[model samples]
Target: MVQTTPLVDRFGRVATDLRVSLTDRCNLRCSYCMPAEGLAWLPDERVLSDDEVVRLIGIGVSRLGIREVRFTGGEPLVRRGLSGIVARTRALDPGLELSLTTNGLGLVRLAGPLAEAGLDRVNVSLDSIRPETFHRITRRDRLHDVLEGLQAAADAGLGPIKVNAVLLRDVNDDQAAELLAWAVERGYELRFIEQMPLDAQHGWTRESMVTAEETLERLEKEFVLAPAAEPRGSAPAELFTVDGGPATVGVIASVTRPFCGDCDRVRLTADGQVRNCLFAREESDLRAALRSGVPDAEIARRWVSAMAGKRAGHGIDDPTFLQPDRPMSAIGG
Candidate 1:
């Protein structure tokens, strides 16, 4: 028999949003995400097969009440089978909301095919518009490629495309307002995310990370922002009207101003490990069960049990907090 229980934790937050990491390999080595050389990539056998990914997503939608599925990656576009994966997941449920979080490098070629295969939207990671600053932050000089990808995605009918940006102190922090202006002019929704302790280098410091207050203060100098009238709900980014109208910007202050109280997300790493929290030190191994020929219902039960132990918060404010071993790229962010 199939399980119908929603993926809920002790905090009573039902996890309807699922973030699935397609692979642990990326094309760029952003200073904040990983080193220039990059970390070791997961072996082919360890990562979930395209079929395995679809099966798990099927269970999440048909049995576990998943409403939205967002495909993430070290860079999701690098996955050879991304379009097929999206197509298969869409076949599971026509109503299932499917999206992707990518670096926007591959979208120039794949965006049309992905949208044809049923991808509803995309969130591209773009830190700076200037080529020099972009290279400094991402260790790459592909800002022009990313810009082309954005336009390609727009031409493919991906409306309200979102750009996820992270500001580094003395790096690209001063470009917050400038990036926002660029996004506004192009009709893309820009979200500024506060740097978290998820870097592979483990160099993230609370003192060095920019805060939401500072981001808002910076934006206010160039644009008038009032809180968007819409309720935040389970979404992480808090939206603000850019100039008191339809145009808006978002700030995902994951570190300083966490929204864990209403978090409704569950993450699956590329290796098929279920992460209940982004900073979780432990993971429930779903790949082992799938490989061992366990029934789908049993796998669903294991997922439920794993989520039940989720902590009230990420505990970044705790005196003895420790960052997880896996970095943001490996953790599917």
Candidate 2:
């Protein structure tokens, strides 16, 4: 139950969702997210223990009125005892909608167990369908592994599985229909995201990012998209369907069309940092306070304060904006 607690953000807006990063490590280095030089992994000591993670989630669910919990990571499934973590959270509250985002490299091995452990949904990060293009984008030669993982996810009933493809103009813009056709046929939701200014690696230019408008224009030519009415106050993705109820699609136009006004969510990194906005430079370190014997209430107090200071919006609207200093891996996209 939510009790009397109201989840309020910096602007006195109520928050209904929380994104938790399970780890700050990743197996595949997507060119858009990570640089060829690589990122410095957070020290092992800084990562939250399963107990701490559950504790934070409990506070979020109870005091912060968080109805949805999404596990992100360097790759969340890479963490040992992930099934146990998911199981513990499932036992917390039936009303909680628990979801996990992964690179889908190892979903084949863990999807059934995770589903049985009570994960409600799974979102896989897939950019290109071509093995060679996929390898070129993620720098990992495991396209077959990801495909199997997606199938395993569906087979395990950890769906409706969503495929999150970042449509960069030159990279995989041409594959929009290919990605959606497979998902709509199998009844999977596919959401193509406009690459944001989080990490614009390899000469990332505005011209390189395929806008949501372009993607829809291209897809509408093939399968007609009808408005799929969505609940008020949701994530960046705007819902749409393919004429019938068999399959649907969505587009998250963070770059071309920002959704910061109705953004009522916060991201907690694996190292215990709270990022109020993905494109904001401000972040608060909560791990130090959490480990220093701060009670849950006090921890929640600081958390609210940190969230209260969130910017009105990310100013990618500025004509000459540079990408944020931190990589997406650190921010847990």
Candidate 3:
């Protein structure tokens, strides 16, 4: 039987947003996310099958009160069954919000199919507009391909397409204003995310990061910015209107200014573990329970129990805090 009670934590936060990792594999090896050599990919047997993913999503929506679902990955487009997965989820609830986060490598060919399959929009990870800078950051010369993919997504009618960019201290930090100007020109909502400690190399330090304040300062040099009137709600990005108009940019200051108090997200790793926080050290296993043929109600109850243990905050500011073993790639960004 479906549960009417929402997935509420001890801190009174109700999780309505679900982020599902399609796979722990990505094409590009971004410096801040993974080493150029890349980490060992999850074995096929360990990763959740398409059917399993669809079933769990059904449970989350029908029983657990999930309202929005964002498909993420080391790169979601790497997963072959993504379109089918989106289709199945859409069939579950036509009104459910469905989105995807990708590196934009394969979006050129898959964007239209994905949109037809009911993907509402996309958030592409693009660090630089210059080919050389892009290659330097991602260790790949696929900037041209990513740009084409963004255009293809736009042609596919993916409006309000958001671009996620990370700034490395000396690497692309100078391009902050340039990136926002490019995004505004193309009508893409650009979000500058402060580099976090979730890198595979674990080399991330607070000093090396470009804080939200710094990002705003850079943008202010080229454009006028005022906080958008819209309420932030559970959104990670703090929206700011550029030049006081409809075009806007965002800054996700996960380090300097945490938004954990209003977090309403839960993550399911590609291997089927529930992560209550991006920086969480502990994960609740759902893959074993599914493989053992546990009933849907039991699975839902386990998910609720997992949320009940969520801490008040990610504790990144805490002196003794440690980064999770999984990098942003494995953790589904």
- Using all chains and alpha carbons, the TM-scores for the candidates as numbered come to 0.99, 0.94, 0.99
Pairs with backbone N, CA or C atoms under 3 Å apart (clashes), candidate 2: 10-308, 25-74
Per-residue lDDT for 42-76 in model 3, tens only?
99999999999999999999998999999999899
List the global CA lDDT of all models. Answer: 0.94, 0.84, 0.93
Task: Give the worst 10-residue stretch by lDDT in candidate 2.
Answer: 1-10
Number of the top-ranking candidate, with lDDT as the measure: 1
lDDT, candidate 1, 1-333, per-residue tens: 564889999989899999999998999999988999999999999999999999999889988999999999999999988999999999998998999999999899999999999999999999999999999888888999999999999999877799999998899899999999999999999999999999999999999999999999999999999999999998999999998768999999999999999999999999999999999999999999999999889999999999999999999999989999999899897
Pairs of residues clashing in candidate 1: none
User: What is the alpha-carbon lDDT for the whole of candidate 3?
Assistant: 0.93
| Superposition error at 66 for model 1 (Å) | 0.4
Cα RMSD for candidates in order: 0.9, 2.0, 0.8
- Which residue window of length 10 is worst by lDDT in model 3? 1-10
Tell me the spans in candidate 3 whose CA falls farther than 4 Å from its real position.
none
How far is 159's C-alpha from truth in model 3 (Å)? 1.9
Model 1 clashes, total count: 0
Question: How well does candidate 2 match the true structure in TM-score terms?
Answer: 0.94
